[model samples]
Target: MNGNRNSQDVVVACSRGITPGMPSFAEQIAKSAPDAADIKQRRWIYIPYDRYTDRTGPLTEQSAAATGVVIVESTAKALRRPYHKKKLVVLISNMRHFALEQAARGVSVLYVFSPKSHGQALVDVQREHALPELTCMTPAERELRLDLATAIENGLQMKFAEDTTWASRTADFTEVYGTYKPGKSYVMDRFYRKARQKTGILMQNGKPVGGQFSFDADNRNPYKNQIPVPKPPKFRPDPITEEVIAFVGETYAQHFGEIDGFDLPCTQADCDLMWRFALEHLLPHFGPFEDAMRDDHGQLFHSKTSVLLNLGRLLALDLVRDVAQAAEAGAIPLASAEGFIRQLLGWREFMRHLHGETDGYRLLAGHVPQEHRRFTQEVSPDRTEEATKAYASAISKADPYAGARPSALGASLPLPAVYWGVKSGLHCMDTVVAQVIQEGWSHHITRLMVLSNLANLCGFSPRELTDWFWFAYVDAYDWVVEPNVLGMATYADGGLTATKPYVSGAAYINRMSNFCGHCQYDPKKSTGPGSCPFTSLYWTFLERNQDILAGNFRLQMPYNTLRKKPAQELMQLRARAEEAIAHLQSFKRPAY
Candidate 1:
């Protein structure tokens, strides 16, 4: 913790920067409150939220003992982006529920309706409480961290404690990677191996269990229709949740997705139930079909525990131990156990470290253009409605490449209507986008191989794609989406987080999923009306970016294959690709 020692009156200010729904910090303070109350300089606590802002933190019995908690319905964060209706509802409802829970427990709660910013609301809170000093856990988001600093600079005596929610810290990342080096890319496998050794997870006698660090090879078998996919555990909405649904429907009518069918786990009991269900029903088959995609199945034996983990309802360290114990007991396969552990203990931690280390890749010049405007700025809140309308209108009147990123290779194609749930005649793209719009969730394979793969291949702006992901997904945060989109998916970082761009053609999609069977275009075709857009665009993408990508050893095979194609055939494919691009850009919403 960093703060002034002289200040007699200090209040803890908990913001929804990360671990939104957890009551860990509040509980810690509450346990010490009785002892501190005897002293003249007793420390108070405050938790604040804006109405239309984001997801709310859940309240527990311990948090109900807090001296005071504040809730504000701020217009600043609500209109920050046109967040999904369901997303807004989830946040506001959870907050309202928490506040109500606290009030019922006899905790003094200050629920405010502040139309301004969170910062201004904090100032109002300070005046009401007559608190001279404020301290909080360091926020996970870079912007929110800056906001806290600004508040301190602007006269609020503020201090921040180290955020201990995540398994790894910035110091751990620095100890592993050393100082930031430009143009240096760290591989995930190496980092994962180190993490396993350090944490002593899956280790025996100083060696990895099964004499291997990764079971990724064993984890890739496509679903052969042998095993039935398990449906995710669902919870019926209670009165509190129902009220949130009605409130969101009225307030954010313009936001995306339906407010009905809200079945997410909001409390500790709900999360516990979901976790048990995953361990029993999903874990056994999760590893083998982890990357497989099925049109008929959405969950596909995957654990939908990300929301719970991120919200602090479930601890990452605890979950890892549970998985390890289960694996040792022979309840779940080693491959399944190891794969799931790698996600929480490996990729998830790496993404957070990479997000902070890269600083959104702003520190690395020439990877992406300096003048590239953020999508949020373009759709400013003042003119958000007009900007959205204009974007829709422009999609109809413009070329696909009109607003694409103007990088060295000129991948300047504006995102087409297809990404916004408009049918693009391609079954894979249509299905993925529709699912995202409806549910605000998709398994990683669908996101990477299908959604991000097509975006990278088609030259959609990386920043634009990242912003779409930020607003669209329920579990998305700046710390996760940036590296995933720009680094792993789009290769916008010029091969930093990912060794190579995760771009794929129709062949990869056909091999992994059942989508091709329903598509109007043939996955095997590379030209003409029947040609799959992904097939044509794959070649065009390679041909256009050969200057930058031709030297990559991993891409040599695809380059050699492109070299063998007849000149006439290549030209026809390029023409077909342009036609496909135009069709996607036409802004004509197709009937499903």
Candidate 2:
């Protein structure tokens, strides 16, 4: 329905369920509505946490006013995985604020505080309102989409409106990539080039504006004390946000990250300001240092816009168009503009498209060695406190390479405590993990080059690492994290998402980041006590997986190097890898 529809034409439904320890804004709204009983009977629009704003989709103030709005706060959903505390605070607080904004706009809002899951809460709303039909936009994550589809199949009169927030839709993805083929691999460059042509972004006179679709080659210069990195925009929590912080702190005490310094944009206005900050301050240097990491700066030259974009506070197309205009106007360099556009119109869209097209977890499930596949059955939910304790106990007591027999192949080691926040004696890991713990934010480079790379080398279960990423990052969702962790970083999907595993020893890490300088292990060494774990593990991983990886052309150089290494040297590298794994397994975790 259009935004200008009359109130008599639509009914608004609101559910009054609040997550525990949080104030019931929905309940307060219900009590204050002009006709509470009449409001209950009206058809209502339901706004999930991910769709809390009107800027992205069809949910404008006038439309919401016609049929009332249902905003639900569900404890069950938040606890599905012990999400980063800052992530919870951002999501719940933005949702609460959106409800208040709607109420202030003369829209009858039913804010529900439910102890049940979001699905159950929606069912409650359907029954309470006696509604024959409910309308919601397609959810971003596949799991939620499937849940809603099942509800529809089971006789819920629900209609899904098209999601208009993204730059590209599912049909567009299909047009470019066709249907997903199980064992076939897809390259991102071809998809990116097609998207650029289809969208006419950075195109001039029927050609790319700069005669090239990507400036990635020009975008990898490390920060060598050239220009000072601009600080990312930070919003001080207002009273509403402070209350959210307090609530999240008390309720999700064990969740990762502290909520005290939560500074993410919660409103459209805040999002706009952050966007401007990114364009004016960060965008210029963003391209050159996009792959660079620093020990002192966690956000270094990166646009902290992913969280806002994922949360629906900012629309992707709008941001991309504005960025393109700035580039066209010569406000930012071509490399900077192209790099940013590539992320928005290229990688981001590609990941989301792949996520919808395939079962990423299922694709990797078959490739995991039988012994490691059973590891999933043994562990609880991979990131919970119980799972952490269990994994720690197992690692400490069990042989580090117990199941990884026949040359340490099919290694399925559980994630260690070091991944969360403990000192791993590796400066790169310790620094990045600490950043993830404190801020729940890290740029793409830190995630792939440092975090996921180390996890892959350590032989951690791909699913376990993927789950940990889902629980840890603010920008993480099932759709994004699964493809990235399994397909791109770890190559657990057997290179369906990447041409080759993005694996490297300390040389690559040191080249891209300042992390190795502070590390206890020498980046140049491969087998000594001070040997870099990544360096030792790098050779070992290549040796163990050589039979499987030999045919891949991209891996030929690495395989050649492995072949050239002396037999005794290869054996010593294996011994070093075993020692490293054992040490990592037995390392004591310190209380943070």
Candidate 3:
């Protein structure tokens, strides 16, 4: 898998970002055991819109062997879908810096600004250079993979090198659990423990450190403004980044997020500084406050490295290794270290494998009958041609399945305007959306508990919510958001990714944060005009889904409590829940 197919004039096509420390597949191909004379020269190509990595292998060999390197920046690809302006800036700027760094190593680097798809760009490069064959790491996305397959059909002789970006490989997932079956539930804890055993991370004498595999229970202390939340260190834009910011600002002016004060890491040096800041100032407190949300402080102790990690600026396993060492050296708590590692090795890896196993849940989407389908939404009439094409091709195809199980509670409502910028009376919902509008990022808790939770309660389409996450978040990719949103967040997969829907009542929100204090609605009330929307909706959700959820072992207490409610009171709560949904859908301030 590491070696390349035999070719005298093979062009190595690199992805968007390549880790300096890690040997890319192109580098591996360069070092493959081939006669020096038979391999005349190697050409390299880079497409910046592709997706993540770091390892210590054959970097010098690849750079020295390459005759030329082409880094293509596709404006058309950037315009293909609605993305947060900040996300585009980060990706394009990082790509630009990466190209300059590669060129500095004495390689003949050609930077191209293309207004075409990646496949077309690569084909053009091959034809221009007279390269006989093309090779690239298997793309991380389905659409891109399909595009490449089409290019191959159109006379581009290409070979796909194995994708080695993730902490856990596809084989590792298969080893843990045999080939994934539809409707089969996979437990994250089991996979996390097995991964720990395989990697020996945070382990001593063949057992987990701190005498356990997870410290998740200890990592959920809600923030009460008691600890000083460190401001994320800013990386001032260099001239290259400044140019990219200006370009993205004007070109993507209609995009979702803000571009002013763009301070994300655009180079390996900036990424290093950000990592160091997390180690010194953020990791120690990250565990307890990992689940906490604050209105004033959007990212409390969270290491906002997902953007960098996904962009191949930082490696997931590398971070996990460093965190374990830090914990062992007493630089951070075991809970904090374990909590962070769980994300990289457990959730991130699990999501990737599951996404592939399920064909990005497209199989489930394809199964839904047309008459019952509400998942597909039309592209907005005002969108640009590229954006419209992207939305129509992606969204309309995501037709959610109507599973045989009652637990697959059908949620068919369209995503509300509140998600886009309209006012919702709920303080938590409005506050999180405001942050997403500005930064295109929020901690995972806010995503699950506030955004996805409310959407589920209000019966919003899972596909719509999933696409929104894909476009709106800086850290989101299709592989990451599909499992997280459809399975864990909304339970659209019917216990495939998670055992139960991560829904909560207003009490949980009030217990976790101060949002309820600022709202006019009563968190304790489950009925009437002044009742908190979440509180009212919580009971109604239980009542409505009772047929599906009553048999679940985890819902015994909630169902028992629901059964105790008087019939008249239940009717009133349902009416209030409907009123709350209407209030949210109104796209104006609540008429208090």
Taken over the whole model, the C-alpha lDDT of each candidate is 0.68, 0.73, 0.72
Per-prediction TM-score: 0.84, 0.88, 0.87
Report the Cα lDDT for candidate 1. 0.68
What would the per-residue lDDT of candidate 2 be over residues 277-299, giving only the tens digit for each residue? 99999997788889999999888
Candidate 1 TM-score to native: 0.84
Arrange candidates, best lDDT first.
2, 3, 1
Question: Model 1, 404-489: lDDT tens per residue?
Answer: 23243345467777877888888988898888888888899999998888877777777777777877777776778777777787
On a 0 to 100 scale, what is the lDDT of residue 433 in model 2?
90
Order of the predicted models by TM-score, top scorer first: 2, 3, 1
Best of the two (1, 3) by lDDT: 3
Candidate 3 has an lDDT of: 0.72
Model 1 error, position 225 (Å): 2.3
Candidate 1: regions farther than 4 A off: 1-42, 46-73, 99-109, 366-410, 588-592
- Compose the digit string of candidate 3's lDDT tens values, residues 302-402: 98888888777787788999998999999999999999999999999999888888777765544432114433432222244543332233544432221
For model 3, the superposed segments whose C-alpha errors exceed 4 Å read 1-40, 45-61, 65-67, 365-407, 588-592
